[model samples]
Target: IRDFPTLMTKARICDEDGKAKSSYYKAMNDKKGKGLDRGKPYENKGNGN
Candidate 1:
């Protein structure tokens, strides 16, 4: 969300329902929150590898 603040805005511009798909949205959910951060960048614990 913070990383791509204009994502939602761009999606809504063409589609009022905000259901339209674009490259930005494709790349966003593509990760499936694998590296998403709720607080700090290291909040999600892992081997960091």
Candidate 2:
């Protein structure tokens, strides 16, 4: 039962612009779960860092 809501929320996050939200990144950072490094997805690509 509890899993259903989490599943739905995750689906919604993925649906938004086909990218995970900042909250998703934060949660992943805290729990070491699913998501890229913090700020990785939003980093300045001009630096190539």
For residue 48, give model 1's deviation from the true position in Å.
28
Measured with C-alpha atoms, the lDDT of residue 45 in candidate 1 is: 72
lDDT of 2 at 26: 76
Best by lDDT: 2
Per residue, candidate 1 scores C-alpha lDDT tens digits across 1-49 of 5656588787667685455456668778887666645366676679666
Q: Which RMSD values do the candidates have, in order?
A: 15.2, 13.5
lDDT of 2: 0.71
Count clashes in each candidate, considering only residues at least 3 apart in sequence or on different chains: 0, 0
Pairs with steric clashes in candidate 1: none
Please give the lDDT score at residue 35 for candidate 1.
62
lDDT of each: 0.67, 0.71
